[model samples]
Target: MQDRPTPGQHWPITTWQGWQHFATTPPPTAPQPGEPPRSTEERLAYHSAFVTVRTPAINTLATQVRTLMLLGRHQQTTARPSLIVTGPAAAGKTTALLEVGRTCHLAHTRKHPAPPGLAHQQVPVAYLLVPPGATAKTLATQFARYLGIPTTTRMTQTQITQAVCHTYTTAGVRLVLIDEIHRLNPRTTTGAEAAGLLKDLTERIKATFVYTGIDVAATPLFTGAAPNSPAAPASSPAAPSPPATARPDPSPTSSPTWRTPSTSPTTHPTHSPATPPTSTNAPPAASEASPASSAKQPSPPSATAPNASPRKHSKPSSSTTSPKKQAAPAPANRPKRHDADVKKSADTPNDEDFAALYDRAWDILIFARAGYLDDVSAHYDEVLHEIAQRTEHTGSLGKTDIAALVVWKRLTAQTRWATDLMSLPDTHVRAVTEQAVTAVRDTTLPRSEAARTGRGIIAELPGLRTGDALASAVLTAAAPQRMAVYDRRVQHALDTLGLTLTPAPGRYGRYLQLLDDLLSHGAARADGWSARDIDTALYQMGANPHPAGT
Candidate 1:
């Protein structure tokens, strides 16, 4: 059997829970309805003014990287429609397009790490987010927050759109990166509320758009019936019709058939046996007819001979020759990576796959949580077994360290797995794992202490309970774990870098939680900082950046 990558083995960056949080966050409010829309003339005036001012650098390469920014500016200059980008988180999609803003004369900003060199640019660009829990009205309200437009200004969706369109056109705002795009998938009000609001905003805005979010939610946007597919536009001209005779007729009677006439062959009036009819019709007959034949015989009077019959007309039958080879049809949609893909990747080890193992392990962790374990002892034992297995792998990075981190990351969005990890009946194992997790969380202490603490905690908790049962409780509580998980590879990185932190108290979960909090706090306050900012910063701090930036 092929080796399927365990989801527990590879956890993707964002979790199911993360997506929910994004959708539930409320959007800012908007102005009243029925307000008049800004006039076309007004919008044009703004575009004209900005166009006159001239923008900055144009990325020489200009690949698909800048689709959103180019689109925004195109709309501003040509008065064309706007667009929305939708995709998984940490795809580096936004950064690619944001480069457009970097080069252009117009100013724009990212949510975090701030837009580079904001000091320059003819027109000032500002960044705004589509806050959590936003509806159509609220989304409009948030855009107003940064555009210097007021939510209470009492504008209808259409009117608000016009004013905003006008502002971008006039102000030369070429692009807007709507980070945390998954938030648009709200559970409240049948979900269409958020979808409708986004559709409305795209229609109303003159600026180009860049949407960033989790891969699953973005799947529908890019793959569903939406126009964002990789397919060609529907409006293109179709292949020309073949010749009329080349087509097949539905009616049998209309089908072409070859026919022959019943007329008998004609005989020469007199075959002299010495000569043929050529003699009579030949040049000698020209002696009888042609000194005047130079007169062209009056062009044969433009008429056929009276005795002449219609000649047979036949079309060659359709040939059955083998068909010509054609190029394979291109897929109309983007390719998606699934579990099978992971296995396929593992079989063929490359730098990319090697780097992605940690994430792959995380996925395994999620899949493991489909059931709950009640016996605390069994749970801890299973957890230990898992850790031990991870430690067996050989690579530059220690398998144990990576496994620890993977477990911690997975448990964040799926805690039940850890609490009910295994079916063993040993209470001591649970204690050790818990101790390991706790030790990691208490950043100031050594990991050895945390391991001991976990053991102590388990010792104090009574009973040789199965870890599975506790896992169920953990899942039921929906409590996020506090520890940041670290693996030996991670430890090696820290050690090599000469950092003093020790993994004595907790496992990877402790470290992950701590880092998660710090980054989350940073992102929340930064307003325009994209999820990428947090990821890049953390990876740097760890001194172990994912090859592709994950």
Candidate 2:
């Protein structure tokens, strides 16, 4: 009898009941790849019609809000900075807001877990669309609706506000999502009263307020703030969305990705020399150049993988090469399926300035990803992030734990692999995923070998056999600091930058290797950068190959 949330309800979140349903009901059995057509017509129709496309903007927005949640959790006072999401209708403003709310929902559940038997009717997130002809009392009633608090026609706005605020506080609501904000005209007496009520609720309930409306920045929403209140950040940039997209604000520190930096050819695969050699004088940093089996070479070590060789090798043959540059040599021990990865590292720039070859394309990516570098990079760094730190990755693993990780991977990648994920029995899936994640979490394993060990195990699942994209995301979610994400876009960006990443079987490990080389050049956390940040940068570069800046 329980209802599940549709993808529509939460491109931006879930209803309280929707969230409860997921908490209570176990997932249904997913069909195997080779299984015959035993599912009903309704199921087939549902599968075909329910499509979930990944949206980078939503990921960015979700990451931003999650970061904000971390900020609020540590605060000593109740007042938190409110966010306003305004853009043209159909631009996914509501979707972004809801997604953030859902993120908070999951994060809260993860933090405070309770089984169905012990679970209470606690509300951590509330989503409300500004009602048509909204007024102070009407808006207050909307708040009451979510909590199922009865409001009679005789109830005064003050009484409603007191009841709503007290209930939300008791329910432990942390996120208050308000959409269709443009419908409220602050200039009107009623609109002003509604606005005041909103301010009062935000102050009294101890929750972060997020407002979404159409073209609200230029509307009265911006100017209507009481002179004494902290006005919504003058221009709270709208998060990105695929449909009716909203533009993200530009990053101030974002510079030309095309600026070619010099790198040493002979440095270790794990890291390049602080000041790279002018040329490839020494042997190409034995990046997959010398297969571990092909020669008596010791496995190289990266910061993350102290015992294993880095997987990716970027030997710039020519910084002058126009669009579409070469990738670094592949690891020597890669599967025999491909040979390009094993090629010797070229005697060229270890580092090619992003601008030198793909300035325009990379510049555009920088414009997008750079704006959220701090938030997105820190996406997994705290309470709201994806991966737990090395210390907290302990305890027994279960199907739900694995399912949670799979969900995290889907959210971060924004892909619709739910069907693929459902292929294996939940228990079997958990067993395989646990092994893979455990490999990466091993503090003693060389970072490179840990990645290889982990990637190998996860690849056993149905959808992961062919590509490293999803597998890499899973691994990164396992150890956010030690691993970077890889996908076609990251690959394309690398190749376009003239960096190398062959399509060989061991590409996942090599990709991390490449990231280490890049990170090494900048020095370990010198600029507070990590494998994830570099991965995001490269993803940006590959995502938009032909940017306007070019």
Candidate 3:
């Protein structure tokens, strides 16, 4: 055999077996260099990310998303934590929420984007926006979908709650987001009542919820908790023992503020034979008993208490029970006039009452945009002038007549005025009507409807689209003429600011979707953003009609 090679040397093969080994043996290889780890963007690209927003906030929102994703990982075996991004109009709450859904690896998220701009996230990390003209059922349908609950054609609140709990529990969701909460209130009683039902469903569900609204007051049900509160300190300082005094008088404004008694205290009889000696002393005048006392009166032992010991209490019999038991206390009556309701009612619009106001303002915007504020007939200007004077004196279009007058003046003005009136409270709408007419004395009229509609197009603005009913009134007043509704100003503002490149639309739904997508894109770039930022930016975009330097 050939001399054997050394231990460290390559072996010499001469035999058939050695040749076989040599033929099959692997080569001595050089070390391979390691490739760099993939980044979030790379991984996301591999997954085919397609968000389209380009705002700077997106990067921040992306960071939040990573944190949330990490948090979600820990939550995979438990309830997921809820994330709510609330802010005023145009704040990117909805968009940021969508970014979470798009970038996060949570099971899946239900996205419900609403019209006229309201976006929210809900249980199981589902994102939803309360419909523009939301009613209780409209909201319920969305809730049911997010929770994975089913509802019948005519499901009741009880049914909705059961479905919500069952679905949320089954889906392993821990959070729910409600957006554009302020639009919940409606002009009609039916609308208001429906809103109340939605409010109740939210309270009943156990999922952690985040709600977005224009103002803090608009969402009293949610953020009502003390800021940075702990878990109720194990137990709240025992609800202070109510002091003895007359029952609190019913409040006149307690229409929708009914406090449902989840577990009513057992009602005591008017008087008790087994009454403790402590309470048996001369009955204090009803006026003297604190309101708490009246609400908690014990029944006479002989009539209502079957558990009373025979020695200490007389037995109650069927005969002792009156044909009609005294009426149980009605639940705390609903708040007749919560500030929201008061504001809504006071702001409600009516027909011809505000007709003239609309007419005059319409005329003004038309004239101003068309560059013809000096050719209108003197009488037309005078009518607007008079209506403006009346609105200023009244301070608000609370009455139908006043709204009609305002509408009339608005329609006849030389420049477009509808967009300006949208954000103002009724009081401001009235005052502004006064100022607009005073500002333009001899505005020219558009020669024809076609010319007028084409000459002045108001950019869609947030908070401007009244419901179908209100829109109908204004559109009708302008007559067979088609004027683009000022319903998506925020979107237009974003586009104008170069924050977004998407073209704004006249319809409310389109604009809402666009904004949601943009915000989501922005949010995906980083941590979540404050609603104030979104709102402030949009407001600033619109505050200057000429786009801030034009």
Candidate 4:
């Protein structure tokens, strides 16, 4: 057995090539007697850390999305078609969009000359998350918020919409990415309303829409059908037929049977003794008689002569062998001829059915298909393993400390809160850290009591607001098993499971209850994993559920 790494000790960075290698390298087996087993809290803490890996699917999808944005920028009269990029939780849909956002930002900054009369640089891409159970007004406000435009509760829906359009137009936004689109429950009236709002936005604004969510293909917004309509079929078209000339004839023997060409001595008249055989050692023979005399002389029995004495002459004449020799080469050359014919037939384009077979167009790019999860899960598991390895030497850190770090990382990973948290004063950080510890401790209380306590603690965080992502992150970190972060990714995961979190009165409470029920009654709890593990798993499932055999 090898010596195990000490907990909380920082490993030399030069020893590892990449996070992927660090994650996949197996750790030492269980320690000997007197040594302690790894704690569950440490495992949970490592699993909850934020990491980003760009898989092949993410890169291909990002390239396609960038191409669409470029096309939208060039279009003058045409209404650019909306793009839908959806997958299971943790599929990295948001990460891909963020990459696109970075590209657009870089392009904007690199422009040599500012557009005439523009006070600020034009933003080519506007990326925003769709609020949970978002209404038109809520969505408009979110857009405005992304644009850095002041939004207030006092503003009417129409005013917010107008402001959003005006700001995006002025910024020269060519593309808008609306993430967590699965939250728009098509089963309710709000779903249709949200779809209508998006359609209106595209018609009025110059930007093309890129919507990302979980199993978005199942939703009416992408399927282009009513919620109640028959489900759209899912399949790729059949393989195309070979061209007419390439098609085999109906006759059984149209294609010749494969066989080795004959190399027998009897087939060569000159080589056979009975068929006027020529000797290899002898000099060439010259005809001595004139052509007239040769023709008049009785031609020695032709090799094809049927009545020739079989006892004396056993082999056939050149006349009988010539035709077979010519036919032998035909079979050898047949395939090449057939292929050329097929090519010619394909180029002719005489068949209407063949043209029609390829006329279909694709509007939705469904990322959440079978086998997607396997790729994403392997990538995520590798990341978690790497974190566990790094933190192995830090065993002295208490569960609360690990949990607080997890909360901090997750909260700050959000685009809106990242900068604010980084610039926050030390006193505010300490308060937030204390609140996280308390929140985790309070999970032992009953549901109602815990909710009340959790809400109070969340309200105390310096920069956090009630029902926002930061507050939810703190609460989720404290009691991960019982509470879940109600962010877009979580919502999309729930939607993929055919579940909905209604944003009615007491929406946060209802959301918590829904997650609790899911853990208790849904497949999520079957593995006996902790709430935090389940949350992470579901987020991955929503982001990019691995398909079969991935």
TM-scores of the candidates in the order shown? 0.26, 0.39, 0.26, 0.33
For 1-550, candidate 4 gives per-residue lDDT tens digits of 0112346654321111121123334433333698666589865554444333433333444455555555556554423444554445654455556555555545554674456655345556666677786655666777777656787655665677788889888867776767787676432223333544564566557876666667665544444343211111111000001101111233665431111112222233122112110000000012232311111111222332111211222221111000011110111111111222222333545544322221110000011211121122111222222223222332122333333443433333344544555566655555654554464456467443464456565554434543434455555544443554455444545454434454443445555554344333323213232344334434434442321100
C-alpha lDDT of residue 159 in model 1: 57
The digit string of per-residue lDDT tens for model 3 on 1-550 reads: 2222345655322221232233233333322479567778766554452233423333444444344334444432222222223344444444444443434323332233323444223223444566775544556666675433656654554566567666665655444545665454322222333444443433344444444445423232222221101101111101101112222235655321111111111222222222111110011122344422222222222221111111111221111101111111121222222222222322443433233332332232222211111111112222222332333454322224334533432322232444454434755544433332232221253112222232122112211232221232222223211122221333334334333323223232232233333233342221222221232223223322221111
What are the lDDT figures for the candidates, one per model?
0.30, 0.49, 0.32, 0.41
Show where candidate 3 strays beyond 4 Å. 1-84, 102-123, 186-204, 213-550
lDDT computed for candidate 1: 0.30
Winner of 1 and 3 under lDDT: 3
Please report how far candidate 1 places residue 471 from its true position, in Å. Answer: 42
TM-score ranking, high to low: 2, 4, 3, 1
Q: Give the TM-score of candidate 4.
A: 0.33
Instruction: After superposing candidate 4 on the true structure, give the runs of residues whose Cα lies further than 4 Å from its correct spot.
Output: 1-59, 74-78, 112-120, 227-550
lDDT, candidate 2, at 493? 62
